[model samples]
Target: MQTKTRRSMIIIAIANGLLLFGYGLSLPFFTIYLISQRGLTSSMAGLVIALAGLSRCVSSGISGELADVFGRKTVMVWGLFSQIVAMFALGLCIELKVQVGWMLACYFLTTFLGAFFRPASNAWVTDNTTPKERVEAFGIIRIGLNIGWALGPAAGGFLVRYSYSMAFFFTALLYAVTILYLNRQVQDNHTPCKSRKPSFVSALLSLKDSRLAKICFYVVVITAVNSQLVVGLSIHCKQYLHMPEYYIGWFFTINGLVVVFLQYWATRLMAKIRLSTAMFIGCALYAVGFGSVGFFDGFTLIALGVFLAGLGELIVSPGEQTLVSNIASRETRGRYLGMLMVFYNLGSAAGFFGAGLLSDYVAPHYLPGPWLIVGAAALLAGWGFWRMRRSLTDEEDGKTNVPVPIKKDTITLN
Candidate 1:
C-alpha cells in the first residue's frame, strides 16, 4: 500500500513538475521576447507579468472555493485542460504575429487558468496525507518543483536560440504530456464539500482574525521579497553585470541542484526547529543575500548570493506551507491555501511592478534598486515573524492563550 501510494505521489509530482517547468522556461524570457519581437518597452513587459499575477490572485481564490465545492481532482483536471488550451493559444499568438496587447491578454488568460491548479494540488496532498506524512510529502513536491524550474529555462534558452516558436511548441507539448499523465495515472476520490459556496469577500474578511491575518501578512511580505529573484535578478544580471543570457539558466540550475540535494535533509532538520524560527532565519538569509548584490560585481559572488537565497528559500517555503496546512481545518483547506496563494500572487505582482518602476526611473543603477527593495521586504517579514513567534508556539502547545480559530467549524487550531 505504501509503495502504491508513493508511486501515485511521484506521478502527481511529475505532472505538476512538467507544468511548472513549462512556465519557468517561459517566465524569464517572456519579457525579453516581448521587447525584442513585439517592440514592447520594459515597463510594458513588467505590466504584462503583473497582469498575469493579478489574474492569478483572482483565479486562485475562485478555484480554491470551486475545489471545495467540487472535488480536488475535478478542479485539477479543469486546470490542466485549460493549460493545454492556454499553451496552444500562446503558440498561436506567435504564429499569427499577434500584437503585444493581445499577447498580454492571452498571458493573463493562461495564468488565470493555471492558478486554479495550485490550490487544488495543495489541498489534494493534504487530503491524502496524514499529518506526520505531510511535511515529507510537501518536501517531495518542492523537489519536483525545483527540478522542473531548473530544467525549464535551460531547455527554453536552447530552444529559443533555434526558434522562439519552438519554445512555445515545447511548452505546449509538455502541457499535453502533463494532461495525459494526470488522466492516466492518478486517482482521487475525495468527496466535495456540500456546503454553499463561500463568498471571496467573506473569506477575505475572515482574515481579520489577528493570528490568521498576521500569518497571511508575513507570507505576503516574504513572497514579495522572493519575487525579486524572478523579476529583478535576471534583469540585474543582464543589464549591469554584463552576464550572458544563457547564464540565467545556470543560476537557477545551481539553485535547483542545491535544493534537490539539500531539501530532504533540510526537511528533516526542520523537525528540530520551530517553523516560525525557520521562516525567520530564511528571511534573514534573503536579506543578506539580496543586500550583498550591491557590493559584488563578479558572477561568482552573485551566484553565491543566489545560492544562499535558495538555501533560505529551501528552509522557509516547506516549513511555512506546512505551518499553514497545520493551522487550517480539513474542510477549509482549499480556501485557506487559496487565500495564501492569492497573497503570494499579489506580492509577486507588486514586486514585479515596483522593481520595474524603480529600475526604470528611480535607480537606473538597476541592480541596487531591486536588491535594496528585496532586502527591506525580507527584514519586514522577519519582524512580522518575530512578533508572531509567541502565538505560533502557544498554538502548537494547545494553549488557550492563542487566538481562537477564526471559523467556528474548524476542528482544531493546530
Candidate 2:
C-alpha cells in the first residue's frame, strides 16, 4: 500500500477504536439503565431497542447518496458530531432522572446518527484501497473495532456503577476526539458528484450487476444469525444454561479477544480460500455454535458455542465487505453500501424482536426453538453463498485483470 493510504487506514482504525470503546462502555448497560432507572418493563426495553433499529434503518435511507454526493469525510464528520450530542443528551436524561420517553428519544437520535457513518466509514475504506488490499485492510479495521469493544466494556463495567453520567461523559469525550482525528487525518475521497441528484429507487434499480443484490440478501440472513448473539444468546445463557450475569459479560469479553488477537491471521489464511467457500464454512460454524447452545448444559459447552460463533464472525466480516467492494462500481459504491446496511439494520431488528417473540409465544416450553430457527436459516444461507459463487466470473474474484466497468470515474486517495 502507498504511504498515504496506509496512513489513512491507521487513522481510521484509531478513530474507530476510540469511538467504539466509548460506545461499548455504555451500550451493554443501556437496557439495564432504562429498566432500573426509568422503570420500564422488559418488553418496553426491547421495544426501545427495536425502535432504535427502525430509526437507524429510516435515517440510513438516503445516507449513501449523501456520502456519494457531499463526500465521505463530510458525512462521517456530521455523524460523529451528532452522536456526541446524542450521547451527552442521553446522559443528561439519566442524571436528571427524566422520563423513559425522553431516554428513548435520545436513544433513537444517537442510533440515527450512527446510520450515516457506518456506511461512510466502510465506503471510505473502499475508496482508499484497491481490490487486492481489501481483506487485510478490513481485518486491520475489525481489530481496531474489537479492541474498543473489549476494553470499553471492561472499563465501563467498573465506571457505570460509580456514576452513569461519568461513563456517558467519557464516551462523549472519545467521540469528540474521534471527530478531531477524522477531520485532520482523513480527506474527501469521493469523486465530484454529477450535476443532478439521483433518486434512491433509480440508484438501486440502476445497478448493472444483479449479483450484488443476491449477495446482499445473503448478508441480511447471515447478519440476522449474528444478531442473535446480542438478543437470544444472552437470554439463553441466563434463563436455561443457568449462567450468571457476570459470566455473560465474560463470554463477550472472550469473543472480543478472540477477534482482536486472531482476526488478521484468520483473514490472511482465509484470503486464499474462495470467498463463497469461506462464507459456507463460517455460516456452518455459526449454525453449529448457536444450535449446539440449546442442547448443552455444561459451562464449557456454552463457552465453546460462544467461541465458535466469534470464529465465524472473524471469517465472514471482512470477506463480505471485500466481496461488496469487488461487485460495486466506483460511482455507486456508497449507495450499494447503504443498501446493504438496510438489510443489516432490519436484520438486527428482526433478531431482537423476533427472538423475543419466539421465546415468549412460540417456544416458551421449548428451550431450543429460537436457536434452531435462526441457526437453520444461517445454514441455508451458507449454501446460498456457495450457489451464488458458481455463477461469478474470474474477473469478479480478482483472479484476472479483466475489469467489470459500469461507469468511468477516477479513484483518488488523499
Give each model's whole-structure lDDT.
0.74, 0.76
lDDT of 1 by residue, 146-167 (tens): 8887888777767666676667
State the lDDT at 367 in candidate 1. Answer: 45
- How many steric overlaps are in each model, in order? 0, 0
Instruction: Give TM per candidate.
Output: 0.91, 0.90
lDDT of 2 by residue, 196-286 (tens): 4746765456344567778878887888788777666665665556665456666666677878999978877766767788888889988
Where is the poorest 10-residue window by lDDT in model 1?
395-404
Q: Report RMSD (Å) for each prediction in the order shown.
A: 3.5, 3.5
Quick one: RMSD of model 1? 3.5
lDDT of candidate model 2 versus the reference = 0.76
